[model samples]
Target: MPPSLPFLLDRTDLHLAELHAARLDGDLVGVGDRFSPADIAGTVDLRGARELRALSLLPRLPVGLVVERRTAAWLHGAWAAPPGPLELCVRSDHRVRVVPDVAWSVRQAVLRPDELILVRGVLSTTPLRTALDLLRLPPDDRYDGRHRSAVITLLLMQTSGRERAAAALHRSPHLPHKQRALDRLAALSLR
Candidate 1:
């Protein structure tokens, strides 16, 4: 098994002695209040610790909101760039408001148990579902459905099998953007 990465914050010791110990051992460096790999100092650049930090904070987030869309893709390491803000999803029955730097999208239809997964110990949409959602996003400059087609296709192909991804889109007939996802999937499959 690979060695576990250092904790984003030392929870056990309130004073952060573990972080200090790591600093003494030359294993970690401090940047303001956060810590990063020792080689680079002055900033907390969490290149390898991103998943650990996200997973560590999962239990602390509000209930019923699973990470989704671009945030999920970034957590899955399928996206090249870091997401602008946290994207979370909740059922329409739940009244969640967008917070500063966090985007909360509500789903009219409830997500099935299988449609979500514990990725890196954090609840997030399954690979197939994430891809379909990406295809369903509005046509905006940042990630219009068309612009993300290639990334979504590759994400599905790598994280979930292409066959399974296609099947998921087929099964979700109620999705408002189901046809669009299907069309995108078809175009990608032909490549």
Candidate 2:
């Protein structure tokens, strides 16, 4: 067996010092600072806590929303220019109201509760919902025809994994929009 690596944080108490400092300040500081093993002294292991903090707090906040390519790009801070419109995918079971300032459209579908996951702090619709929603968007709402087609195709593939896309489509008296969504999905499949 290879020789065991030195327990730098455990042996040197460096992680404890940093946590104490951060707790006193009520914020993390020098989070990315590198310290040589020589900089720490004592018998204390705080590496696990340090690792947890590094894993949890330093990254971009997760947005609990079922997003498409455009929304994903925007959420990741990757877009240098304004996106034309925001397309959001939501479950047919949830009540959603779009805010006025956002230029957006919705694609509605059934999402299994088990598939929904928390992003950041909000609940996001599942991948299956994302795909079905893409299929339900109007052609005019999708500015780039090729990109739109690709998203729809991807959603259809996702749909195939679950069951026939048509299996979820049904007339809804409570949800007239769902009927429109089903019709749109059917129309797209034909083309």
Candidate 3:
């Protein structure tokens, strides 16, 4: 028989009470019998716990965490991963919120989950989104050519964006250089 999965618990301080309340309300879903302390503590709030429980209740499939530009940079070697738990960007109220793993702290942005995807175990922003986000950053946040090329290549391989990519570049408010990149990407796709 397969080894039994351990029980997980909701231990995150901000979500503990909320998780407990959700459990009482029957709103939390999960492999209830398999909750471990680590699972409970990792959540940032009751809603997060509810979401986790819902995810856990699904047929257990390996799903990578979704990430954004900064997190992608850390995962891709442009920057070092922080010592503590990593944060992820989630959409809410027509804005993005960066929620820390242990707290309720969040920073708002005009981003959405549709702009991200999973790549090689890391959640990375979609190529177009990455490029757009990068364009908004100062020179200090720019990636080297190697990383930029890699991001473009992966995005092309993963999405059907021959036209959308071009349009995104054309409409970008940040990176004027994107037109050249878009032309190059389009040419490469035709080959």
Tens digit of per-residue lDDT, candidate 2, span 1-191: 97632322221544777755643564432222222232222222343323322223223222333444444322222222224455455567766664443454456655567546444443444444444444455556653554345445445444363245446545224532465566555556423
Q: Give me the overall lDDT of model 1.
A: 0.60
Order the candidate numbers by TM-score, best to worst. 1, 3, 2
Cα-based TM-score, every candidate? 0.61, 0.37, 0.38
Model 3: residues >4 Å from true position, as ranges?
2-66, 70-107, 112-127, 159-163, 172-191
Candidate 2's TM-score reads: 0.37
Model 1 TM-score on a 0 to 1 scale? 0.61
Kindly list the per-residue Cα lDDT of model 3 for residues 37-77, writing each as its tens digit.
44343553643443343333222211333444544443332
Which portions of model 1 show Cα errors greater than 4 Å? 1-5, 9-50, 56-60, 92-109, 141-160, 189-191
Best by lDDT: 1
**TM-score preference between candidates 2 and 3, better one:** 3
Question: lDDT tens digits, residues 36-126, model 1?
Answer: 5565433434434445546544644566577777766665556644354556777555666644344334344467887777755677776
Pick the TM-score winner: 1
Q: RMSD in angstroms, all models?
A: 7.2, 13.0, 12.3
Candidate 3, residue 137: lDDT: 45
Pairs clashing within candidate 2: none
